[model samples]
Target: MFCRILRRPGVLLNQASARSLNRAIFTRSYPFLHGGPSIDKKTAQKITVNWLYHDGKTRPVSAYVGQTLLQVAHAHKIELEGACEGVCACSTCHTIFTDPVYDSLPYPSEDEEDMLDLAYGLEPTSRLGCQVTLTEEMDGVEVRIPQATRNFYVDGHVPQPH
Candidate 1:
């Protein structure tokens, strides 16, 4: 009966559901099925970020997939001055990537590039930390915060003390 059911068209069985069905059908039978490719176990990828502060302290952090670099920094209480609050209007959150993994990040938008132009100490790897999203491919990424951004302002107004 189980073989007949499995032989029918378009029958999909996930691991959990398959195990449940197997247990119900054959009470003392080992839950093992032949045929079909083995499922690959998923491995969580890690991203290593180094926050280089103006005071010469290097804080290392680990981030998982789908987290923005800014989010990671903020979670660790790292001082990355985002004067425009990550709206891409100010260059206060500017940072440079020291690792080759910088190239793995997506290209910046016109707005982010425009903001970076206003940032001091703009290097080839310069980017707005808020705009960089962490991916599995971005492992071991190193970023350095510039000293000039510690006191940045937006529209001539300073951000209030946090």
Candidate 2:
């Protein structure tokens, strides 16, 4: 009886279906939850970035090529918080691209779209810092960090770590 049940083909199909359902449910319920991007330090180089603070202050720093904006900000002691640790998960790292640089970067991903939708001050050229990688073309990028972030669920409760 045990062998027969183990060999049942429907069991495998049911398990696969359940896994797919779980993924869809989780993605929909928590849009700002995701894994980090693959990092290759070999591609690391130096670049320049200008950060505009919420209080009308701007600062320039040397950032590493291929490093996400969130990483550079954190390393330079900027006032930005990557609540999701550069995983493109939380909108806590939401930033606005200013002028010429905004038109140079690639478009945002679907997951980024979902998180940006929940950001406090969504703009036409807003992007998650974790999703934007530094490139040669983006040498002099200008990013603006908002004063506060809306780090809560739709129910007005902060998300708890699992």
Looking at candidate 1, the ten consecutive residues that score lowest on lDDT are 30-39
Cα TM-score per model: 0.61, 0.67
lDDT, candidate 2, 28-143, per-residue tens: 43323443444465666777999998889989998877778887887787766666565555688889987567777888876677767768888898999878989877777789
The residue-level lDDT of candidate 1 at 88 comes to 61
List the candidate 1 regions with Cα displacement exceeding 4 Å: 1-46, 150-162
Once all C-alphas are superposed, what RMSD does model 1 give against the true structure? 19.6
Q: Candidate 1 residues 1-162, lDDT tens each?
A: 674576456887544444444544565322124221222225546668888877888889977666666656766767777765555656777888864765767889766776677788888989997678777767766788887764565466643322
Evaluate residue 22 in candidate 1 and report its C-alpha lDDT on the 0 to 100 scale. Answer: 52
Per-residue lDDT value at 58 in model 2? 88
What is the C-alpha local distance difference test score of candidate 1?
A: 0.66
Clashing residue pairs for model 1: none
- Model 2 residue 69 CA deviation (Å) reads 0.3
